[model samples]
Target chain A: MTVVMKMKDIFDCKLLMVDDEPELRKMVNEILRREGFVKIISASNCNEARQIFIHEKPDGVILDVSLPDGDGFSLLSEIRTTSAVPVLFLSARDEDENRLLGLGLGADDYITKPFLPRELTLRLRAVLSRAYFPVILKRTEKPIFRLGKTKIDLNSGAVITKNDQLMLTAKEFALLEKLYENRGNIVTGDSLCRAAWSDNLYGYENTLMVHIRRLREKIEPEPSTPRYLLTVRGLGYKLTGVEDR
Target chain B: MKNLMKILTRYVLSAAGVALILLVVNFAALITWTTQSGKTVRKNYDIAQIADSLLRSDGGYTLPETARNKIETNRQWAMLIDNNSGTVIWSLNQPSEVPQSYTVSDVAGFTRWYLNGYPVTVWKHPDGLFVLGNEKDSVWKYCVTEPMAIMDNAGVWIIIILILNSLVAVLLALLFGLRLFRSLKPLAKGIEDMAEKRPVELSTCGLLGDLAAGINDTSAQLKRQEAALSKRDNARTTWIAGISHDIRTPLSIVMGYSNQLEEDAELPQSKREQAGIIRRQSERIKTLVSDLSLASKLEYDMQPIRRSEIALAALLRQTAVDFLNSGLSDSYDLDVIIKEDAQNAMISGDEELLRRAVSNLIANCIQHNPNGCAIKVTLEKTLGNCSLTVSDNGVGFKQEMLDDLNHPKNSARLENHGLGLTIVRQIIKAHGGITKFYNLAEGGCTVVLSLP
Candidate 1:
């Protein structure tokens, strides 16, 4: 419940949406505001987008690839020169080349045109989470973490106490991260499986259990009687007594 | 053609004719000069006086001034044999080995053939036949010696003749080469124009007339092919553009309104579900549009790789993360295995294309194995190549799917199978890579992408 409150606060961020179609901008604007975005600015072309961007200084940007005066990619590049603010591209051209070019140009994400309303909102939230707090940084390698009497170094991918160091595989680390992301909250088993295996989450109940057992042995004071890593039975898994944001 | 060969033979015949004329002229000059020089040598012989002196025969015989002067002027040697006395007489410039005496038979044999291997003229004498021997330098020397000035003049004339002959030969060879090149120049120009993709027309004349005709025909055929191909390509491009510009905008409007209705709290639950269905169907349509457009572009090789240096390990990791965040699946197991060295392995490729190629493979696995599956993505660096292997633990692809993947045309009946595989093959090929599908023995499917 507290996590939901925190997410809603983050959702109330300001954003800039740029598109050539007036209907698209209006629709995206209404959707974003309804999703808790407070101050949303809209632009029909790159030139206007740039002006609004500089003046409003929105927290993030959702830019269309094609514009009247210039391209969204050029606008992103131009904005990147001055700031590292998050920029997501909305393009009708969904070719691999275009997507790669957009992301390679420093845009946070590339979404093809005619995207689902929920999908747009979710991507916006993801970009905002990453830009403000860098959730993705911790996914690969986070800072030092304290767990019970042990110290977990996310950067080194090593967990060490006074006497010994523990090794964690990439999958194990991701599983631990899902729990850490929702610290003191239950992350459903399905969510954990999806985070670990992506789309192949079914029939992985046994695999997830095995990884959880191994993770607990390294962090818990007793492998047989787990302490820090706990199961919520009908729910999923949770990690307690871990210092997480 | 036979006509061309006949015209070419004339060049060889004309050169040969010049050589024959020079040979005849040289032979005529040699005969005339030889006869004239032989008359002078006979007049200078002075045979009467030489015989008188030999007949004096006092063992102190002396040659007359005329005969002595002739010998001195001619640089000749003389010898006399006394056949009646059976003795050899005094000799001038005689070899030391010559005997002083001779028998009748010896005198007869020496005069008839030679005097000590020298050319000798015989005359009737009282005691012995008077014998005048030419010098032994040639064994059959000419009695009339050539003057020093005449020998030098002969050498100069021989060199001038050789120089003239060489100059004429060189001039003829150059003229032949120039004529050949001029006749073939149109053919060379036609070949160059064909290489440059330009319209070519060569005048079919001279030796290469047939070759010129062949080349012009080939050029015309190739131009026609190029025009037809570009026309088809432009039509396809316009169709794809239309799908993007015309269809997606209106689709976006329909999707936006439906989404708004779905989100309306006041709407009844069933009405909201209906709106949700509309949005879902619209999303499906959007996917189909993107797939069809990209597939067509790939089918005709319209897409080109835009290359950049990519750290492959990072890409693999990012791909796995994106799949997880895509929200497309909630019931699949995905795992990534990256070799230690592969973390820094880099290759030049189109990153977006590679990303899409890999994502498509993973998506295909999830789509096919609806119930559940375990997908493993392994990134490893081999000798000079990087391989990305995506394997799944589920019901592998059917025989028909594998066949279509390998040969797209064979499975034209299969709707999405051909399109997806075509895009995969095209993207990988554009990056200078290869893709393969294998049914693992463990009842799973595997796709290996190797890029240099």
Candidate 2:
């Protein structure tokens, strides 16, 4: 709890809380206020909520799933278009479908309703911590693997080589790293489900397969014959050649 | 038409009932009239002569030869007998065999007689003795029959005619009664069916067609309202999904930039502090927006249930463990009692949705109850359904609030009241199931749910 609060105290941005229930809004406000929040705003409905968002320019917003005039989704859309503020949905709508939908709609985090104030605070800190402290950028000097003149920096995200000419999309990089990270773990078709869809892993194996194939075409030395990555019989694909075996 | 036939039959039966009552009344009147007129018959049949003779000193009285011959040739034999010894003193048909005397009191007791094909009356003389006679066989038999005798027979015929007339009156009353009811039945049926909110089955009976038509109009209006409500519900659901998608785009950018800022390594402590602020506030915004989306989803349509065979007992136990592991179980004491042999109670429903339903029930218990309050969850299997009940010793709802929930027809605006129970209702309904909310007499609320 202290670690989460420590991370949250570093961020000095405006916070907006929207819920129809006054008690809940007050409870959340008290918790965030004690954490050294610089500015805070609250609204009971979407109509008033939109005005608050426009005037306050909050960096983060806490919203109830249900509102009187409209809902948090519409308000999220309006705020997202004109401003860059991460929306974290705190709702009593705890169904998996709801959570999946919220995440799919670019929600940073989904907290079920009747949540503990401290739990929400912790989640808020974790999310805020991710945004404030950048992952350590490992410096890689070894160039063990090369594909399409793209020398793979296995330790760091850097794709560098002797020629120093490489281009790839974020999706492509994520796919490649995912395959290499499970070098010997035999990452099954089901294991990569949540990372992409953030939902149930049923009947989505083909979609993951397509993403993997697309990643290989971009990085493989020869598109038709992959040297570094190998598919195990009747199981799943694995990354080879880490020890040059 | 079958309806017309029904009306006709009812009228006939009613008429028959009335006619039956009249027949009884007429019979009583006929018997009374016959009894009173019987005395008149006795007086005309030589009853006056008998009284005059008894008044004289001697019993024997010599009549004219013509009168004697008439008496002797009489077809109905006459006998005067001694009441004490059964001795005959005078006889018309056989003087040797019949008794000669009869007690005057005994002679006056005759009540009935049959003459020819028609029934005759036997009269007891009010003054003297008995007289039993039919229409006389004489030249002026009609004239010989004293005017009183003629009157007695005529009176009998007239009373019989009166009885018959009363029977006709009853039949007419019954017929009219049937007609009146027939006309009102359709209207009555329409009113009854209207109360039930169903289409009236009665085709308009005459005089009630307008009433039936009115009821049909109201039913049509109700249908229109139902259609409009259905359309609105559909539009609202679609709008929620659309709005959720719209909000996601900018949210991604805000989150992306916040992530980038936090990851910058070369930044000084002051900038990093600023970056931290940016990231935390961005997250708070995301929470608020997602909460709004969830609110809209609840407001619109509940997510459809996808059914599959699942063991409910296992699912409930797993959910309990999940809640406990999530740290809510410790804050609020949880007591779980699954019925013995509850295993193999497989149900067909959306597993995730069912889980959500159970989770909401448990969450409500935890939320409403004070810290350290015991929350009880029980699972039982009944015929053709599995039931799960969640109860807590929390502040229960009032009766009026329960009434409002039971009957939502009041168009109550419970939108902002909270969606935990409302969503529970919607999900249960989608599963073709139901939920019951009851406040225990001691304390708190218990929600019982049943699934097929």
Candidate 3:
């Protein structure tokens, strides 16, 4: 059974935002509210953030690096001592050191200031879902991709059709796994070769082509025209399904 | 140290020259004094010739007219003494105070030295001894004798003495030259310190003390100027960082609200389009702020690079794929070509900075060609260097822009071209790489980044 995370469930998650600026807090709260989140709490300083964090037990956090009383890094450390809630740092400090430090301190994501509202919401939702929904992330491990009439099960390394069932070699399975992961996007030939050979694509160009042909024969309904598996000229190969862009 | 050696050599040479001049002058003076004395003796009568001219005639000795004339003209006297009797046998032009006769010892003393206070020269005669004497107190004479061995080796002795004198001159020159070098050594070190921007302090209590003082003053001035320049650079970088930081929150507000307005269903299409423009411009401001801060940081070496080994072909492919997946419009297309041999090419660099460099190249191509363009990114490994080329089939760069990029000091024109290529150059330079910008012949512009 395919288990899907409901948008309502994602909206129901509680979020805590800690920032020194009042307008930024209000704006973030408004943005989250517009994105269908209902329970959004805010703290203007480290002390207030600590108090709210302990009392409300927020499911996710949007933190700023510089707070009035103390910085968010220590606050995150304090939060981590008691909880594993997802924390994303939103700050005006765009330096790489600050970002790395924030992420090193167990932040789920770091978004610099002057970010688009859509980007902010999307990152916040991703962090929330990652922390709360393990099954949705695990679904990728046992994914089933369809190429026309063929059904490829990545977990079992099986390609089943109406006429017969075929098994994929270990190398072919690794190659298809990479292509399926970037299903609608172009995956370069070098990336595919590395996936199959665990090495560079220097001497494996012809071998990659042969493996790709074999893969097409098994999965593509018309291997000659390659309806499912397509090659982007001079770039790479792109795997597409009936539903993919 | 080489300069000190030169000084010593010049000093020794000049010292040797002075010694040579002194020797030449002394030799010339000796020659002149010897010649003058010899001429004076010759002007007097020759004693041996006078003795030979004396002959017994008519029971008396007679002197020749030439000898008589020589003695008269010089106011000198001549005489001849008998060997057995020790008597004055023949005399001419003799002073009245002269003794008429002499014992053998007296004859020996007067003939060898003086007679009656007259300087005399004696020569052996056939009959007895011959004597020629100047007037009383008219000349002074002394006699000297030496062993034959010393006289025979006189040339060797002279040469040894000359060599010793030269050695002493050279030794003294070296001593003085060493003193001067010691005094100037600190000044040389001080100049080196000044060149390296280190503090310079020299002792000012020697022959070169005034020079040391001047160098110290110059170093102080240079240090002050250096400090002032660094202070100004820091202020520039800090001010840019502060302004960029301050602008972020307000820009974020504008961007967030405009983005919301752009997506609001209640807004009219035209209003939404205006909101979109505002949002887009705010985004541009955001990028500009970051770019300004980054450029300032790079200029001041404030940006620390976090280096790691990166696969060149993989990075190029990933960047192209990201641009394509990020909704690069249908108007634009990008192709990544990795040479077969270059597939394994790797370089050590800061991945984020390199990615930014590549992204800026692609963005520059797109920004300049608003209508649309095809960007080709090719990676190749040549002579152990990874070469990445980004080219576009659109309007090539203007000649002015190319000139600005080629000579970055013409930064005034770069303001129009933006900091995109400047940052690329800086990033590549930081990684020990080079960047080239040129217009392709087939109506396109290409930027090639070569990294070792």
Candidate 4:
């Protein structure tokens, strides 16, 4: 009950969904369609997801962390660079560092694998509410991509507190950047390793992961059950800010 | 074969020890026999010499019969033989018509026969006359220099002593054989204990303490190994527990999401998106669980590594290319270099596992590098062995950071909690190969896998 209160009212917006699994895509589409999300589209893979994005022009998007042709995080980044659609990373990479990297990349919030539908909805709404706040409310001067009081500068690759800038290693910075870029996609270990080091993380990928954990410690509000960076098991990490994945 | 060698070694040592003791006793007996026989021969020769000289004296030219008779009376029985002919020239207290034909030939035959086992001696003269005598009473001639009484007793005692000496030697040899065997019994017992995996308590032989110490040390080592195995079992249990807990948490979440989607009546699009998110998260959880479980299985699984003869060079090329394609990075900008000298390098390994391991390595390379980074994969074959090396020109790890790749050290860079390389190590170890990760000097990391 206490965790649920953390959810904030988000901007009421349209959303799109993409995945290879048709049943999954349809189920998600149906769920969102009933939640007053008018624009809900489903895609099987990267090709379909691209098509849907081009066609729908939705305010927010939900993309599977993994797709047939490519990963969802890259799609999220591609979308973010072009369109400021609030992207929530729905990924299977449930490791802590994976989620941290997704958030570091630019994702607002991260929801791990096997999350409750309600939890996902609540998280998405909170992220959207924070992302599309009215200008007057924004003037209250809270930093963007904040976890509690800590501020993450997604662009500058800097984490700012009340008075100091936290130190970050190269891998930490890369992990953060990857999360920030996706903003709302689950950045799986594979995706984060790819995004951070530009390859599939093999045997020593944990090295990059440790750095993310350290980064999380610096920027995360609680550092446990992280708000900005979240783990999605088996698939990847995700930054939570956009619609539910 | 080892058992056979051990038995053989035991037999050899025992036989050698027995043979050594027998050799020393036999040597001493031979020395004593030689010394005693030499003394007896010398004494016999001395007596025979004295008898011969007395017999050779010219008594044919004696002063008178009266003097000869007087000498014979004083000496008990003195007989003189002819110097040139086998005849008795003078006899004191002789019977009339006494056999004068008892000559040197008779004495010679009797002496040769007696020397075989009897203590009789033949006294020979250069003049051809001879005399044979027994110590009790001289049959032919008795020399004045010899005391007959003393000689008779000494001869009897000498025969008795020779028999006693031979008996004693045989008895001593039997006793020594028993002692030698008793000394060797401990060695045999030690070997038996070793076979049974029991402690070998060796009695201290003056010079054998070193060997005993070696046996004790071996037993200590075995105990240590047993202790280590128990510790390993404990660690394995802990690993299993950790895996179960980590996997269960995610599964519950996935189940919760499914239940929500089912119960909620007018699920809005936003709620549906959340469900989709929940479903994807579940999938991710399942994958991590499987990976962790796989790692645990690899640790304890005793099943032999499934091996197949595969063209390793081709596999490397294909795996690398597949990994490159799977990477999220833009491949057009990255420069990937692969070098292979082997046209057909055949290796025996689990194909699916090796491929997966290679894929993971390639994926790591792609993730670690920036856009347009150069990567190299090399496959080489030499002397019935093969090597595959993957190197990337990316942000190479610091010396200290690279040290923990395969090494089980807890480091900051080792936080992925992924069993990717752990699986790689297991797979390679199963194939009787080794995998090593190191940082490149120019810039990047290199992973080398070698098989024999």
**Candidate achieving the largest DockQ:** 3
Answer with 1 or 3, whichever has the higher DockQ.
3
**Model 2: per-residue Cα lDDT over B1-452, one tens digit each:** 35656776676667766666667687789999989887765454553353233222266433355444544554444434434554544434432432354454434333222323222233223222333343334212221446777787987877777777666766676667667666766766666666766765555547667776777687677767767987887676566555654454344444444444565687777787787687676666555544445444545555554568876765676576567546564568666666765544777887876787788888777756656567788888877778889988878877876776656552314444455566666667677788888998989888889877
lDDT of 1 by residue, B184-239 (tens): 66677788889999999988777888999999899999899989988887697658
lDDT of 2 at B193: 68
Per-structure clash totals for the candidates? 11, 45, 0, 78
Runs of candidate 3 with Cα error greater than 4 angstroms are: A1-8, A96-103, A135-141, A193-207, A242-245, B21-29, B36-78, B82-85, B89-98, B102-118, B123-129, B135-152, B203-217, B327-343, B371-385, B410-414
lDDT of 2 at A145: 59
* Model 1 residue-pair collision total: 11
TM-score of chain A of each: 0.55, 0.51, 0.83, 0.48
Ranked candidates (lDDT, high to low): 3, 1, 2, 4
DockQ of 1: 0.17
- Evaluation by DockQ, superior candidate among 1 and 2: 1
**DockQ for candidate 3:** 0.54
| Residue lDDT tens for model 4, B1-452 | 35544554565556555555666687689999989987975653443444444432354533345444433443433344566665766544444434564556754654455322223543445544433323333333323566788787986876676556555655565565455445556666676777777877786664556666677677667767767985785576456645654554446445664656756677877787777676666765665565564565566553235578876654665564454335445542322333345545677787877887776776667656646466676777756677877778777765654566667553212246356666776677778888889877787788888888
- CA shift of A169, model 4, Å: 55
Model 1 residue B369 lDDT score? 93
